[model samples]
Target: MNIVSQEHQKSGQQPTEQVTYAAPYVDIEPAESGYVLRAEMPGVNRNGIQITVEDGNLVLVGQQQPLSVSGEALHRETRQLSYRRVYELDPSIDADRISARIDQGILTVNLQKAENLKPRRITLE
Candidate 1:
């Protein structure tokens, strides 16, 4: 995850705090029974991520835990960051049956298609 901190400090201006968010890379695939959404959010743990489906939109929110450094670091690469991503879901999906899980910074959301909307074959006797 690329974390960018917004620090506005001028010669005589007071520093202001700004919050920025990074969007995680996501992959969506269609399956025989449903759709799968996989998001890659490095530095984010399971407890730091939140997922919800609201108003036909799948919302993902995540925050990286802050690192406690005892002394000044010679080199710095990572930062405290937050993440957010939203995807508009189709009405054919069964929202109630949706499932989500996270493993090794990978978040997977399974959206099951509505039973009535699934393709089926009819036998003609």
Candidate 2:
């Protein structure tokens, strides 16, 4: 994931036109062994996307180009969009083993469970 400093908008400041981009949808699920995070980021390529983990936080960034139409345009009404989402990862996640892949317009991130976080069977004395 790309690391970007958060832009703080001043209070009462007029919203910028660039904020109209579509926000990606994300779903987080807990499995028997780990956590799965799926994000919907259509119209984005591998080069346009970035994912990074820093200070126990997972960050996702990407850009999407708006559809272009040329020649004899009578009516056009689609806007271009892009977005970013940052998640504060829990300590139970094994950050070093995290993996991600994009398929069918969905970005899937798997957070492996830390060795210490996994359940262990103990024998009674």
Candidate 3:
């Protein structure tokens, strides 16, 4: 099983302001039933995440809430960061059974194998 990440660019108002999305570090674990994916997404709320499956790919999007400041800031590291990561899903994975949840800035995605891909037992003839 292999999951590949592709870089994507986000259009900005100004041509010089083009921003490239940062892919969060992910941890994948294989299981007998399927695979478990864990992604680190700090400062992202539950409502800020969007998960979708399209064209044999799993897409993960997270929008960090913009920081509010009454006075003008002299300097800042990340003004408003957004996350966009896409993973190529294997054909054996059942997209319909996929589920995800976020807890303490950690996103967990459960990928279940297709019914036909599961191991079966055969009776002795």
Candidate 4:
């Protein structure tokens, strides 16, 4: 019958394809003293993230794993995500003083400005 043939065709179809998402949701703000960067990375822990400064470029690399589920269902969707971002640092930034922390699924990176970069008071002679 037509119904039986349609059911067989549907069953023959392949499962849903997996997808990988890259991290691009980052916010950069310039404060009076330094620069702050906030990155949104859910389901990622501090151990999975890596930050490094090399050759005047700041790089952020991390991976996000898919959630696990129990019980079999009619349909399912799961995917792994990874991201890497490179930022060119300004000469005024003190790379040695840069620090980063992650809290509640948000990663914050603070880049301190060198003492020379700070505004200095100018007095007339």
Model 4 lDDT on a 0 to 1 scale: 0.73
> Residue 71: error of model 4 in Å?
4.7
TM-score order of candidates, top first: 3, 1, 2, 4
TM-score of 2: 0.71
For residue 39, give model 2's deviation from the true position in Å: 0.9
Tens-place lDDT digits, model 1, residues 19-72: 687878889999778899898877788899888888888888888777666988
Residue 2, candidate 3: how far off, in angstroms?
20
The lDDT of each candidate is 0.80, 0.75, 0.79, 0.73
* Count of clashing pairs, candidate 4: 0
Task: Tell me the tens digit of each residue's lDDT in model 3 across 4-83.
Answer: 23332343234544455667778999976899999887778899999999888899887777766799878877535677
Clash counts for the predictions, in order: 0, 3, 0, 0
Question: Which candidate tops lDDT?
Answer: 1
Writing each residue's lDDT as its tens digit, candidate 4 over 1-125 gives 00111213446775465334365478999976799998877767788789998889888766675567688867755334665677899889999998988777688999889998789998999
After superposition, which runs of candidate 2 have C-alpha atoms over 4 Å from their true positions? 1-22, 65-68, 71-79
Where is model 2 poorest over a 10-residue stretch in terms of lDDT?
A: 1-10
Off by over 4 Å in 1: 1-19, 122-125
